[model samples]
Target: MSYVLAGDVGGTKTVLCLYQVADDNSVGGSMEEIYKAVYPSAGHERFSDLITAFLAEVTQRPERACFGIAGPIQDQCCTATNLPWVIDARQLAEEFGFADVYLLNDLEATAHGMLHLSADEFVELNPQAMPQAGHAAVIAAGTGLGQAIMAWDGQRHIVMPTEGGHCDFGPNTRQEDALLLFLRERFGGHVSGERILAGDGFGNLYDFLRTSGFAAPNPAIEAEMANEDRNAVISHHGLAGDDPLCTEAMRLFVRIYGSEAGNLALKCLPRGGIYIGGGIGPKIRAALESGVFMQGFLDKGRMARAIEHVPVRLSLNPEAPLLGAAHMALLRSQG
Candidate 1:
């Protein structure tokens, strides 16, 4: 029995998984026995710190390793987007005593994991259609917005990482333009989808609504939001229909999310489909299914027909990136 190690490194947490590869070189089973281990990325500036902790928790050393990171990977070195840590693959390979080590953008991992997911694992947002066999897009929102695309090249899906999320936010209407202006003022120009679609974007949207005198639940909730990061709190309230302001904020977020999804689809010409992955999509499924997202997605005027034909689905699995890393590692080991 051969085992491989995989890691999903994020801004807030890192997940490690061990997998058992079968005779056919496919993952037979996996045990996510380890979780939520404290990784002070700021203090421990090396990938070895986290790898050491992960090794300490597991009994056996993995033959190979791969990591899905939050930042661009170039020349075998990766710098995390939300953290100060820099990861060098050569250094990690030497320290871990592995024959091979692979690093990929987090969204790339998400795209790879799509091949491993069963239909039951996904929730279809647009059921009236099916994905065409061409290209597929994956966009996720967690600590930041991440986008990637996979091209169906006749035989297999080729995963490609993108900086589409960093592109300028193009507002459609007056209200959206106002939101863009607000974000620009706060961010000092170059408002990207990341500005309005990430974790921080939720709070920014809520704050905008509150300031615009939208109806809120109570002064106490507002105070709680002001005192702390309020996106999750506000999102929960909005999802539960507790606060009008939160609900409106969420609606706007969904609209922007759908529009961005549309933009990505257009750029990629993703006939295969659009898969929405990330921490935020699963949490806000209700709002996304409430027609706001779909409407915005299909509201591309004359091009609405193109958007309508594309199927949209949400990835419900949080361990997808880890699985993707393991798959990448497995492929490399076999090769």
Candidate 2:
């Protein structure tokens, strides 16, 4: 028997899992999940410390390990985008006494995992979707916005991670033009799409609407924001239509989210598909299905028909990154 360690490391949280594999250790080998846990990313000062704690609770020592991290990976090293830790694959392997270790960008891992998921795990948003063989794009908005491209090489997909989320924000409507100005002033200049599409975007959008006199600020929501997760509160009220300010914010968020997804589709022309993954999408499922998102997506001036039939899917599985890491480790181990 052999063990594999896999992790999905994000800015806000980290999830680690241990999988027991059959003796064969082949790509077709059977595997069973033995343990899994989630931890606050900020609780550990070093990535090594967190791994050490995880290992202490388990009796088996993994032969190989892989991590899907939220940052750019260069030369097997990563400086986590939202966390204070710098992770090196070789260093982790040496310190942990593992035979091998691999690091992949979080979106890359998600893209890889998408191939292994069952059909039911996805919700196809494009009614006119046409599934075919080609490249695909992934866009996820979590603590930050993540983007990746899955290039199909006739046999398999080669996942390419990107920092495209930090690209310049383009406004398509008059309201978005005002939003750009507002975010520019607030961020001191040059606001990225991530500023309006990520988790914190709920609060940013709500504040923008309130200051714009869209509606009177709800004192109850304000009080809740002071104590609880500001974004959560806003999204909750927004989804429920309990407050005009939050509802409008939610609408704006969905619009921008759809627009950005369209932009990604246009850029890559992911004829295979474009997938939506992140913590925020499922929670706001109603808003996403509310036609506003689709309208924004199809708003592409002349190029609308080019990608109109391209499938857009939303991944319901939040553990995709971890699963991808595990499968990737398994494949690498076989080689």
Computed on alpha carbons, the lDDT of every model, listed in order, comes to 0.82, 0.90
Model 1 lDDT tens row, 127-166: 5667667889898987889899898889778899999899
Misplaced by over 4 Å in model 2 are 23-29
Compare the candidates by lDDT and give the number of the best one. Answer: 2
Task: Tell me how far candidate 1 lies from the true structure as C-alpha RMSD in angstroms.
Answer: 2.3
Q: For candidate 2, what is the lDDT?
A: 0.90
| Clash number for candidate 1 | 0
lDDT (tens digit, per residue) of candidate 2 on 136-195: 989999888889999889977889999989998888998899999999999999999899
After superposition, the stretches of candidate 1 with alpha carbons farther than 4 Å from their true spots are 26-42
Residue pairs in clash, model 1: none
Which ten contiguous residues of candidate 2 have the minimum total lDDT?
Answer: 23-32
